[model samples]
Target: MEEKKFDINTLIGFVLMGAIMFWWIYSTQPTPEEIEAEKNKTEQVKEDTTVTNPTTSEIILQAGDSVTLAKAQTELGSFAYSTTLPSAKDSETILENDLLKLVISNKGGQIKEALIKKYVTYDSLPLYMIKDNNASFNINFGTTDNRTLNTKDLFFEPSLTKKGETQILSMKLKVSNNQFLEYQYEIKPNEYMVDFNIRSQGLSNVFNSSQQINLDWNLEGFRHEKSIRYENQQTELYYEKDDENIDYLSIGGEDDAEENDVNWIAYKQHFFSSILISEQAFDNIKLKSKTLVEDEEVDTTFTKAFYLKAPLALQGGELNYNMNWYIGPNDYQILKKYDRNIKEITNLGWGIFGFINRAVFIPVFNFLKGFIGNYGIIIILLTIVVRIIMSPLVYKSYLSSAKMKVLKPEMDEIAKKYPKKEDAMKRQQETMALQSKAGVSPLSGCIPALIQAPVFFALFRFFPSNIDLRQKGFLWADDLSAYDSVFKLPFKIPFYGDHISLFPILASIAIFFYMKMTQSQQMNMQQPTQEGMPDMQKMMKMMMYLSPIMMLVFFNMYASGLSLYYFVSNLLTITIMLVIKNFILDEDKIHAKIQENKKKPKKESKFRQRLNDAMKQAQEQQAQQQKRKK
Candidate 1:
């Protein structure tokens, strides 16, 4: 059998195919070495982390103990029906003996129209309920939309303990024979947390059994009338959860047609989850669904806990629930100690990729933040550090682009010599040959740039979040948590909203200059493509105009800190590119290198030979079929 000769075109096709394969593999596949290292690291992490449990104790106050309801406003009833309403505004209440510190304000004085001040949930403005599973419980009476719910009418009482710690004053209320029987509050302190328990005396259990005592932490004047959406927000981290339990008991609420009604909004720095407790059992519960609100792209989980079988019931004798509340920074070190994975609330985003983000990106950010006090500075330092790490790849990419730049003249000549569409194929072959002779891959520069895209995007998502940056101001910016707009407009622009940010404008300008410098190198080459050269040029010009414009508009209302990071990174990249072009690349030496490659031994690749054979066989079959038809 005669040996098959490979066409240059065929070899180029194989090369393109190989490049696509390599890119696909590179994007998706972790190298075996990386995989092995990851596995070892995972094992080490597991070995290092020890499980710890967080527990809280409850205290029961005796009736004889004279408790000062320091912040008590009023107690209403005629011996039979009595209830204490907290004072709306008496600074700090000091409960002494039997006298209540009542800060009476006409604003909040009714029990039916009271407001819930401090019942903890996952969200800031959460819903209140008469009964846990009652469908009416879905109506959110949170303080919003010009509605004011006075804390006085909302809370029973507020008091400071003997230790000076703030505590809530509440009476054990019982309803019997169409009468409301109320008892005063008592406080006792213990190590770790303060707990207040009130007991009712002379009141018998109704229905000769357990009567579920439903307390009202009502939002008197609050109403939900609108929904909201966000272009960008904090990312939440998610964990693999078994969502088999029923968390949604009764999803009732008037659908606010306005897009502004938030199904759920991402709180400042916490995860929002809905837990469904049954009227029967309210204590023992299990995590149910890990969900994200519709159209909300958060980084972490929106989990719901379902009381295994309805809420734990309270026996008529008495019902007691010890709530553990955390009211400080969500430090992972402390959160992880609880073992509840409450630390996961620091929104990392979801799925396997989310795990990688939480396990990798977050830790890296935290580590870097330790040294770099300022977050903006940390971003800059991180960018420089990443560039340094990827320097070897960057050097190779620059060398390849430089080689292509040097061959522009010769490549232009080949294009001019072959104007016909058929000869256009032949011209491309010569260009490839020229590129190969120059010891450069046309695609080499592109791959490294592509590799950096993920890191860039990951950081973009990371910084807007990373609560450590919240309220931390760098320069002219006030709060890094929100956008640092130099000026606010009275009107809103579509998609962009109403604000003017300087950082994105500076960034876009840097990008423009960077693109301009890159394309300028190709300007000396006179040859153009066979078709649509004018259109390509037009597209390039359009990109130059469009990209910066879009950035200026989109980032005008985004966090200035994020925009600053991109701006600094772009400026740095431009400087690096300039350095490579000016100092590292020599056009004369590159041309000489190309000439040297032309004299080396050239061998036909087996893949190239196979491709040519396939193409030839296809041509032969097509010719035979045409002849038969004729």
Candidate 2:
């Protein structure tokens, strides 16, 4: 106040206080219409939110509430219900026998879960063929009220009855006091088959008799094996129609098929199946199957999903449909007992290979399993038995190789004599003559090996589908039916997979050594090479290495039992080769025998004589071509 002059800070504070006071006064005032509009906007959002999210009970009630009894009576005439509607509270009833257990829900009056009593999944949990909203069985029809109705949304009253060893569960959907739609399921002790029958009582007026009822059945196949990829590769939908051959969908991808007069439809998994068989054939059926990608959150427990829609014919005013459901292991003997050709789902193989597995391998394996508890020892015994049975053929093959080895020096002489490319035919003829004189057939080695191919292929089909090997463990393998991983990789390797399987690696190593031993024995044999022909030794060497690598890659994802069989088989073969080389076969004796045969008068068979004639003709033609060129 000395000079009555204000500083810059004091002037700024006065201006800021005046501006704040003016803003507060302006915000406190509002019009009546603006407040009403803001309240209306907030109410609108609350109404929209309520409409979007509804409770489960509300959804269930909506289905019934959408059509009142008065409206139904007006549209349906005398068929309308005057009683109270069924409750929406879902309930489940279980019907279990010694072999299987089924949970039936009131909502659809269908099977909500199916569990096999004797088997468990790969994770040691109870095996569920259908569960967790993955299966749906519904009947779709037009009601008297002209509304398309799906039986899945309606609740049914369930009743249980028992007679001796059979248990019957009946679900009834009442249309009136005495009229109803009924589902009767009968389960017997120690049986995997369930008898299912649908009957209608005095409901002819309520249903549209002119139209056929559509039965929609769907099931998602849960994973029961250790490898989801393998299980998916084996899962498929199979059906039989018109008492003819059984048909199936592609096992790899999504596919659908239309069929007529279907007798049964089977949802086949890797080791088990669920089949629906009709007493009277369905008129037409449409089936579809889809492979589910592996996802830990959603699909890790399932392999594929299947859908089937079949048409059932209704007669007079009532519908009576009879069917059976088989939910059990895919055992060949057990399925064959049904006599519906359902055993074809086992997929042992095709043609003679399948026949061998069915006729020979299955019986032998089962017989061995009866006495031997350990699968590993049984496999060893099986290998020994097979080798013993095939000893004569193996001996013949080895004898052929021995003859080639003993004659290597003379073969080299023949090769040296025909060094030029034009002399190939002459050298071949001379070699054939020498082989004939020595009583050795050039094809002897390959023919015996070829004869054993059926057994090999038969065993290839045997191990993977053998249910007994499913969870059996041996040595380092926790499950013989699945690949035995010694080490798991963080990343997948293109064709090799994401794990190192010990059995396949051991099998590959055995094969490599076996090839090495055989290759060394045949190294001295000389092959005549033409100008454009590839080097035989190099090709053979490449095959020796490439074959084992291929075995390692291909069998890495195959069943451990199969790889174990190969490993043991190869080791036995190598052992036999060593035994033959050391104690059974002597080079001196073989050479002496060959020399003795050569000294004798050589008798040419018709085949050898014909081959010699052909060689001469070829040589003559080559000579003529050379002259023409000159």
Candidate 3:
């Protein structure tokens, strides 16, 4: 989830108009004497209205209360006609395309439920984007007759009509047949985004002049993945504010923030999201989120809760807005087409790491996936391609390490000569001189290794966020986006999780071997250790073991796709290193080249000359200080 720091805008094309006028339709509350007389007149008329089920949208009349006409007219004022327009029974209207199905309730004129047709939950149930009381959308405003009204608390009359390929559902809270607050939804076939336009007609004078209109949207995300904690770690609130800049709140925490000019709001639940988008700016927006699951919880029903509230415009006495509801998978390509920067919600990473995924790995992998059926084979091929691209750097690094290996005996002799504690600076100066004469700089090897870091980090961000891998099976893993458990444990391990994942175990073993193969070469290339400095060789050896243990523990719950990538990547690295060391590089030739280079006059770089001058100045200062102390 990416966040931008600024106020939020109302959804695209939201233009609020003043409430329309209906003067003769509304009447003031009846007096106590008139109410008593009305009750007396209704004593003989038996109250027979019974509700089998009541939704949140209904203001149900009690058994003892009068269902008389005049009482309702007094209470509803201008909206009294709503009682006659529709029965308060719980009725649902459905709008569906090839990919999505939405069940809208007439009670609140809100989408009561949604199902992504192409997908299902982890347990194989239908994947409902909104269900039961888990989600709601409501508008709040005040009426002129000293009364406040919430759309969710009133009954809306529903009408479904078609415009060629588009299906439009109009839910109206009416003052009359032609005058009401309208919640209009227009959905075209085969699209995940639905165009929603909210506007009222004819009742411009009924709404209170001093009141502000607001929209309250809330959702409780369902458990879609096998692991609650893992999915929850990825689930978060994302929005766009201050135009194109993006930021995100830390996951697994509760926060309340207000932003100005926010363009969109995305309630992300890992693989899928429910996003609200607008073209114009909405001000004074409040965003809130809270985690639902606990670390040691038993319930796994839902993952998190989210809330968004922002004021709406009332222009020309009518509430009007044009917006879109995007309820679908967090697939990068599908979202990129919206041009809302909606693709920012897909967690591909940020900056150059994101650029690499977008420019290199993603496009290449997508091209390969078009023809390939098995993801495991695709991963293997992907790893091989990346390794091949990086092979030149691998060769240069190994060649440098080999040259350093040939010079190790002389380097060790220098270490023995500069054994005294105070001679550390002198040791560094002599070592640089020898390496310069040999035409080698230690940083030359490190530069290639450094250049490859972005690719690794990019892949690390790519696999888990890649929805294409969500249900894709690879070798022993049933779902590549989740850990592959070969065995279940009766007892839980703290960081290692409750089950034994085969891919992480294999990945750990692979990295252990790769490190063992190359750490010694890195160890040989280390400069002479100064007094009080930690031993670089010992640290490297410790890391050789420590890295695998960390991988074994850390990746136990990470996506199997990532573990597979690391495993294949390490195996390829080991193979490349072996091929380079034994078949490609020759230490005898490297030594001859180093000896030949030594006979030529060395030209010190400007930076090196400054370093030599600084070392001489430091040594002279130390001698003078020592004489003064004596």
RMSD of each: 34.3, 8.9, 18.9
Q: How many clashes in each candidate?
A: 36, 0, 41
lDDT for model 1:
0.45
Which run of 10 residues does model 1 get worst, by summed lDDT?
A: 54-63
Q: How accurate is candidate 3 locally (lDDT)?
A: 0.84
- State how far residue 60 of model 1 sits from its true place (Å): 22
Alpha carbon lDDT of residue 553, candidate 1? 80
Mind giving the per-residue lDDT tens digits that candidate 2 earns over 356-462?
Answer: 88887888888999989999888888888888787778777888888888887788889899988889998888888888888877588778778889889989888
What is the descending TM-score order? 3, 2, 1
How much does candidate 2 score in TM-score? 0.84
Q: Which residue runs of candidate 1 sit more than 4 Å off their true CA positions?
A: 1-240, 243-338, 341-364, 416-418, 423-438, 490-492, 521-538, 602-630
TM-score to native of every candidate shown: 0.54, 0.84, 0.89
TM-score of 1: 0.54
Query: Candidate 1 residues 99-136, lDDT tens each?
Result: 11222112122112111222322234442311122111
Better of 1 and 3 by TM-score: 3
